[model samples]
Target: MPHLVILYTANLNFPTEEGGDMSGLCRALADTMIAQRDETDKPVFPVGGVRVLAYPAAHFAVADGSGDFGFIYLQLRMGRGRSEWVQQRVGAALVASAKECLAVLLTRQAVGVTLQIDVGAEVFDGKLGNLHPLFK
Candidate 1:
């Protein structure tokens, strides 16, 4: 399972004629993650377990007080047990997807983008709902 949390500065205006909407960006990122495949060419992540959410920071200071400075931070959480190489591959793929999604905003304004992946303890992680059927 993988959950993506997007945090962005409120100074940024989404859905601008120049920049795309945040909701759309989130969906693209989620789809990108779901498309990831392993060495065997099989889906790396469970399609039904992918989730993407975004939060706008109402109050944030980016390097300087200049409102022109914006940022998008992504926190990715997933179950443990993958190899280091796989983890790196997934992280890189996700970040590339994010960059592509925010390309317009990044080129038009001064924006910082970052992604972090966290593998949770298998023992503590719990799941109740099922979206697997939909994927099947």
Candidate 2:
């Protein structure tokens, strides 16, 4: 099965244009998050191979507000075992990653982009796998 992760911090004042610039603070936060992932054992994936994004649409299904500028990271992963409850586990891990210090990266003014960044690491389960979409 395919797994997804959505890590986000809300109410950030990011720019609206495609060329919009993220505040220095948010940039720093992203850098730090990457570093943390590189050192962490949770996802058990390397930083370079991971996908990180902001202005989410896939995993961070926002119910309220518009143009929210929260940061998000999605990482599709594998367990090498059985796991039907992966959704809950992925959701929990994302929520845990989005809390506190990094949350400060967002501002109330940047409500143009969804306060959701998507990071992904599509995994395969004895199948063709999500990686094919990118490599093929």
RMSD of each: 1.7, 9.1
Question: What TM-score does each of the candidates earn?
Answer: 0.89, 0.30
Model 1: how far residue 115 lies from native, Å: 0.6
Model 2 per-residue lDDT at 109: 42
lDDT of 1 by residue, 1-136 (tens): 7889999998775548865878988998898888887777888788889999999999898997755898889999988866777789999988888777777777677888889999978676566876778888
Candidate 1 Cα errors over 4 Å, as ranges: none
lDDT for 126 in candidate 2 is 53
Clash count, predicted structure 1: 0
C-alpha lDDT of residue 63 in model 1 = 93
Candidate 2 stretches with Cα past 4 Å from truth are 1-11, 14-43, 55-82, 85-87, 105-136
Writing each residue's lDDT as its tens digit, candidate 2 over 1-136 gives 2233434445444445422343433443344444432223443333333444334344454446455544445454434432434334444444454443334334334322222323344463255445645522
